[model samples]
Target chain A: MQLAIVVNEGPYTHQASDTAYHFTKAALEKGHGITRVFFYHDGVNNGTRLTVPPQDDRNLQKLWSELGEKHGLDMVVCIAAAQRRGILDADEARRHGKDASNIAAGFRISGLGQLIEAGIEADRLVVFGD
Target chain B: MAQKKKFLYLNRKAPHGTIYALESLEVVLIGAAFEQDVSLAFLDDGVFQLMAGQDTTAAGMKNFSRTFKALGDYDVRKFYVERESLAERGLTVEDLMPITYEDENEDYAEKPSIHLVGRAELAAIIADQDVVLSF
Candidate 1:
């Protein structure tokens, strides 16, 4: 089955993003096609490259980026939510006259339409959040 | 043309003190453009979202409760408010805003949009949907 995932909470502060990651990984291992992974609300924070965890703790941002890269998954952070929370891509940073961009690899900034499209296209849309 | 999918926007939070309610409305507005069969479910504290006369002056937040009135214009006519949720919060349908839509199929008759339903009925409605988005 083709599945779409929506993550609505940030890492560390909530277990939502982590659970979503494991679910996506397991689904992929079972050979199911992941249509898209949409980040909204505080979940957009998962796309930022600026997070630094303790040496012994797991790094969710890196885990997501690597998973996205390996699976060629369409990992999208909602642009409206991202902007509100200060997660910016290089283009967005330049457009807004900001000095730096923090969006990590394998994740792109996009509109909410992508999420609706995913809902329409995928057989199931799974959401992980508070 | 693509077949229309049943999209349910599940609301489980209060109107203020958090961004979930507002942001979920944003998605509903955007998703309306796709022409899906959309429905909004207000349960738990989400029932407060439709409460009449919401004054955010002291809170300094945008009074987005008015936005629900505009949803009828976007062809979003189904709003399922759980009966149990309202009773738990000591609210009745009369406490909610009177949201209505013009029915084109019935000589443009103005009709109420809110549907007060029981938990069992809501579960059945949820089972009938192709996509269920929670906030």
Candidate 2:
């Protein structure tokens, strides 16, 4: 089955991100094709490369990036939501006149149309949030 | 040969307090372009989204309550409001806005789009869905 995931909360503050990550990993292990992973609302925080957790704690941003890299996953952060929360890619940062970009590796910024498209293409659309 | 997938937008939060309600509506409008078999389920505080005579002027925000009226124009007509959620909140279907759509096949006659259902019925509706987008 082709699966699409939408994560709606940020890291640390909520368990949504962690649960989504584990569910996604399990889905991949089960040989399910991941059509896309869309980050909306506070979930865009998961795509920032600037997060640095303690030596003991897990780093969700890095884990998602690594997972996307390994599986060639289409991880997309909603541009509207990302911009509202200050998560930006190089092009977005340049356009907004910001000094730096913090979009993590393996995640791209796109429109909500990608989400609707995921619903159209994927057999299952799973959501994890508050 | 991709078939028309049964897509259900599960809304469980109130409008204005969170962005979920508004953004979820936006996705529904956009998804209509894909011509999928779409239905919307309003449960929990989500039933407040369809409350009639909502004025956001005092709150200083865009009053998007009117947008619900335009949904039928996009050929997205199914709206299931959970009966228990409304009763729990001391609300009845009469408190909600009258949302209707024109049925062209039936001589373009007007028909109510909102359907009130029990929790079990709503669960059955969810189980029938191929894709459930919760907000």
Candidate 3:
């Protein structure tokens, strides 16, 4: 089964981000396929390649990258939301004239159409929110 | 073959907190207005929306939960509850507003239908949807 899991919470607070990650991992372990991991609202922060957590803590951004690489999961950040929150890719950063953009590897900016596609293409679409 | 769009709305916020529900409602209404089929499913805290008797008037909010009943008027007849969430909250269909659903069918349909499933089965819902938006 292919799943499109959405995370709507920021990485710092709320369990939605963690829940999305755990659910994705479990889905893979259970032999289900993940079509994409769409991040919206503050959840776009998960794609920020520049976030710095304490050395003692797990770098969630890296974990997400590993998940994407290992399972080939599509980590799509909402383009409008990501821009509003300053989570930009290299191109977006250049477009917006921002000094830095931290979009993590394996994550890309996409449109609402992607969300719609997720629902149609995926067998299950799970949303994690605050 | 030409077919109507099968749209699923993923509402993640509580009513009255923000415009998420209201905005989502507009999108669904627009889709239905354009002749597409629409369905709604609640997950996690979103399940709270299905609970009965929401009184947000005192909070200076538009009784948005009241708008749920109107979804039927807009041809959005399928309202679903995540069975696991209900169980975790010690709630059930009986605890929610009278929402119509085909509890028997496990597969997706053109008409509105409710799916009562566990976590494992929930993954299938994600896999089956053509479009999924979280609000």
Candidate 4:
């Protein structure tokens, strides 16, 4: 089954993100196709290029990026949430005269339409949340 | 396309505290991906999901309430705000931003429709939905 996974937690502080990631990986291992991963609320922070973790810690952002690269997956962050939290892409940051954009490769900042489309298109849209 | 199922995501708790807010987002998005019509209502403590001008850095948490504004991207515009919940907590719809706030009433899409009702009424609303997951 094709599944759409929604992630509402960031890598730190909550296990929500970890749980979603593992679920997606396992689904893939089982030969299920994941339509897309929608990140909202603090989950949007996962798209930031500015994230820096300690050497000993796991780099979840890098892992997500790699997942998208190795396979064709769409990682979408809600724009409204990103903007309210002051997260902008390189284009937006440059256009808004900000210093930089954290929404970079492996993830694209989009409206909820992708989510809607995925939900409609995917066979099963299983949610993993708090 | 499948007929859009009405999905109302009720969010409680602030961003980065626990995974409540994040988990809600995921479920809602997944619902939408399934071509279900999804709406989000912030009530009681859930209203905090739309609070603006947060200082999460002090708490070592990245503020994601602004993500509420992004609901438009998900085609999530219907918001059911409880009047009593706002007043009891000293919060007014004006205090929140980027939300199409509504009072609990017959017109309010939430269950019971009253701005505030007893727990029994709330339960009926939950029972009516194809899905009602809490944060």
Query: What are the Cα lDDT values of the candidates?
Result: 0.98, 0.93, 0.75, 0.69
Q: What is the RMSD of candidate 3?
A: 7.9
What value does the lDDT take at residue B63 in candidate 4?
69
Number of the candidate with higher lDDT, 1 or 2:
1
- Tell me which of candidates 1 and 2 scores higher on TM-score: 1
Q: Put down candidate 1 lDDT per residue, B1-135, tens digits, no spaces.
A: 378999999999999999999999999999999999999999999999999999999999999999999999999999999999999999999999999999999999999999999999999999999999999
TM-score of 3: 0.60
In TM-score terms, candidate 2 sits at: 0.94
Off by over 4 Å in 4: B13-135
- Compute the DockQ of candidate 1: 0.92
How many times do residue backbones clash in model 1? 0
**What are the per-residue Cα lDDT tens digits for candidate 3 across B1-135?**
145556667766666676567656655655555545676878777777777888886788777666676666666777656788888888887778765433235563344334566766666765666566667
Q: How well is candidate 4 docked (DockQ)?
A: 0.11
TM-score of each: 0.99, 0.94, 0.60, 0.61
- Cα displacement (angstroms), candidate 1, residue A46, comes to 0.4
Worst 10 residues of 1 chain B by lDDT: B1-10
Q: Write the per-residue lDDT of candidate 2 for residues B36-110, one digit (tens) a residue.
A: 899999999999999999998988877898989989988889999999999999999999999999999999899
Best candidate according to lDDT: 1
What's the lDDT for residue B16 in model 1?
98
Question: In model 4, what lDDT does residue A122 have?
Answer: 73
Off by over 4 Å in 1: none
